[model samples]
Target: MLPFRFIHAADLHLDSPFAGMSGLTDRVRKHLQQSTFIALDRMVQLAVREKVDFVVISGDVYDSSNTSLRAQLRFMEALEMLDREHIPVFIIHGNHDPLDSPRLAVTLPPLVHVFGPVPESVTVVRRRDGQEVSVITGMSYLTSKVKENISLRYNKKAGASELFHIGLLHANVDGNQEHETYAPCSKKDLNTAGYHYWALGHIHSRRTLQESPYIVYPGNIQGRNIRETGPKGCYLVDVDETGAVAMDFRELDTVRWFDMEVSIGDCRHPEDLRLNVERLLTDISESYTTGFSMVRIRITGRGSIHRELEDGFILEDLLIDLRRKVDNQAGTVGFAGCVWVESFCLSSGAEIQLETLLQEDSFIGELLRLAETELAGDIGSDSVIGHALRPLMDQPEIRLLLTGSTREEQREWLRRAMELTALLLLDDQEAGGASA
Candidate 1:
């Protein structure tokens, strides 16, 4: 048996529009809109540069079934580049771009082989010897939803022992809760299939579950949102003559996404907070070579600025000022090329510590205890404060907000409310004292 090299990529999701984005400059928006194509182009370039024998796209070449003509043209151009170089491409459609999809109307090059609905094997011969070297067994999604365990149908053992066998699938393996359960199958199901390598798709986070008989998800070639943050790319896999397999990840994303939490526990004044924010943005910019990045920051921990942040006006003004500072530093040294803040949150608590105040035997302390009891449900639903929010909580939107919320999160919210109320009262007292 001879050694071979190939790329296993999936979830191209071409021409996917950014979701829940705001405050973008026209220049940034343009780059984002074309990021998917840019990522795919880089993959093709990598394939050519590395001189791999063939390329395997596990699934989701397009964003949806009704993919735009522009997307199709761009995809064709990339594949054509490989075709001109005499490199072959194997593809299988996932639930996003099923076999019956109307968007697959565009014609592709001869070197491209798209697998059909049923599990079937296609043998490729080594160009050097004209002898069969590898067999690729795959199946495409016929419809949008395949509830059955489709892995049961793959028959890789039908191939001869001397050939390398590869299995391609776009399924929700082992009931991955992050993604919709489409074409569900267990890891055991794939392992038992007796393939040398299993190329998987549908979940957009890369994982190499097994090394002996590589079961891999190369993730999506592009990260479309914050949830899909970090490096996005494919796997360059090499199989040696002795059947030893090795895989290396190659990053293809032009724009990187990051979420950071900046603590303001020691920030005693607004200027102190401003300096802290400036430091954070400056540090983040220099951390990545990608140059362009999207960031979401949460300002957390107890601080003197908590009351001001809760006032809304101060937070809005602070955000505007922070953006101005960041915009001025775009393309400058010690900063990511063009960094954009998606949104910010003030999760800070008041300077007055809640734990210390809880120990007092006073009216305010009693109120704090009551609030904590209601928050923890220690005061049952029969209590006055428990029923106070019951009607509001009954609303559909409110219930939706509470859905999947942990007890810690609920308690945290309650603590924030108590802190805010106490701060307001203290501010009122100070005003009264000054007037007197």
Candidate 2:
């Protein structure tokens, strides 16, 4: 068997809308709206450039349960491009786009092979002499909710050691908490399946469970939310004549998502703080080249300007000004890209010398010590503060804004409380000194 290569891509989520974002400019929104399709085009371009023997899309090619005509047409168009190059595309429908879906009726080109609900095997041959290159075994989702361990259904046929066997599946292995446990199976179950490689989907984070047999998830082609941060794309895999497989990741995301933290701990004035943030934004903008960059800047750490930031109007104005400065259009410099601040979260505290203040043995020091003691111990959910917070935390929106979701979060909440108390006491002392 001669060495051959193929592209393994999954979770395309075609025509998917960006989530958890609002107040987007017309141009940015339009660019993001078309990003998924752009990523698909990039994937096709990559496969053609790499001159892979074939392409395998593990699952979720479309975002909707009832697939849109536009998505169907665009998908067909991409496949047609590969078809023109005499490249074959193997696909398995995932939970998002099950075989039972009432999608737009469109006939795929002959080069495209879609797996059905039942397990099937395909022998891909060399285009030149029709010599068998590999055997691909796969199954598609018939319904959206398939809780059964579908790995149980796949059994490797005896014989044919020379032919490389690849298993294409759209499943949640060993119960990934991030997504529903559809077509769930254990790592051991897949390892025992006897295939050389398992191309998996469902979870949109790339991971390799085992290296020897290569049980892998290629993640998604594009990121559609803040949660799906970083470079998103597919894997280019090569299987040698000796059956040694090598995998390389190729980034295809048109729009990138990032969570950036800018500390204002040293800034003494508003202008200094603004410059600090601007420098950070500039640095981030220069880093990404693909298209647009969406960033959520978390302004954190103790600073002199914390009091001013606590005033709602001030933070709002700063956000408006920062957006204009960062997201403004820059001419095509390739890597120099447009960066938009999706949201600004102020987690910074007021700058105060806590240890010196605590040495004074005052009421403020007592308050600080008390908070420290409480934080050192259990949060005491049965106590007065916790009881008061229970009702407020029950509301989803309020809980989202609240920090204390877990024990670690409770500690952070206590820390922030101590900082706030210390700041307020210092301000009171300053006011008294001025009056005297």
Candidate 3:
């Protein structure tokens, strides 16, 4: 067998709009909107530059079944570029972009092969070339919800011993709770399967579960939100003549997302907090000098600013100020590039003793006590607090982000929220001003 190289990527979710953020400059928004396409373009450029034999995208090319024309056209153009370079592309649709879903009328290049609903194998072949045959076998989603274990259906197709076999699938392995249980299977199932490599998708976090047979998920090409933060990209897999595989992760995101918590435990005033935020923004900007940053600034730990932030409008005002005084300046990312504060949260606690407050006999005390009992009951979703979170949990994508949260975590948050609510309701203007 001859040594060959290829790029592996998945979970494009192209044209997916970024949301739940504010104070975004016009230029930042524009950069965010084009980030997905830029990521794909980078992948194609990498494929051509590395001279890879083939490219494999495990699944979820579009964010929805009703794929946008812009996403389709951009994806098509990337394929055309690879076609010109004579690099083959193999893709399979996941739960988000199933085989039964309707898409715009756009045709891809001949070098692109989109796998069908059932498990099937396709060979990597180019005319006037002499190399051992390698096959890519994959299956796509028939519908958005696939619960049955379909990994059992795949096997190394009856072919010559010299052929290299690669398995591709967009499924949940071993019931990973962070994502919906779709096309669930165990690692053992994949281990027993007679394939040289398993390309997996459906989980948005890149993971390489096995190295001997090379089971991998390249994650989404772009991080769409704070929950999907940090560097996002694909894997450039190089295989030796002996079929030994080595993978190198290449970052391709044009806009990075960040959620940073700045603790004011030792701070006394708002000015101190401002200095901390400036330092954070500087670090974020320096870390990703080549692109833009969408940051969610969370102010945590006990501080005198807690009482001031209880006004609700104070947080809003701080958010506006952060945007104006934030990186790049005047609604533009300058030549040096910068970060934008997408959202602001004041999760800081009051300097007053929590135990003293909880022991009180007032409405605030009762509220805090109930937060640990009735509010945290099993009928949480039916309660007021749960009702408020219903909207976020209703959306599949947002729910997926919350899927990892446990009841204890929710209860702890409920207590903190109740504490903040109690502070907001009280008109204590001087209780914590000693530190302010």
lDDT of 1: 0.83
Compared with the true structure, what per-residue lDDT tens digits does model 3 show for residues 156-261?
8885457778898998888888889989998899989878889898888888988878889888999998878888999998777798889999998887889999
Best by lDDT: 2
* CA lDDT of every candidate: 0.83, 0.84, 0.81
Ranking by TM-score: 2, 1, 3
Candidate 1's displacement at residue 301, Å, is: 1.4
C-alpha RMSD values across all candidates: 3.7, 3.3, 5.4
Ranking by lDDT: 2, 1, 3
lDDT of 3 at 270: 72
User: After aligning candidate 1 to the native by TM-score, how far in Å is the CA of 63 from where it should be?
Assistant: 1.3
Q: Give one clash count per candidate, in the order shown.
A: 3, 0, 0
The candidate with the higher TM-score, 2 or 3, is 2
CA lDDT, candidate 3, residue 215: 85
Q: Write the residue-wise lDDT of candidate 1 on 199-279 in tens digits.
A: 998999999878768889999998888888888999998888988888999999887888888887988887788788767
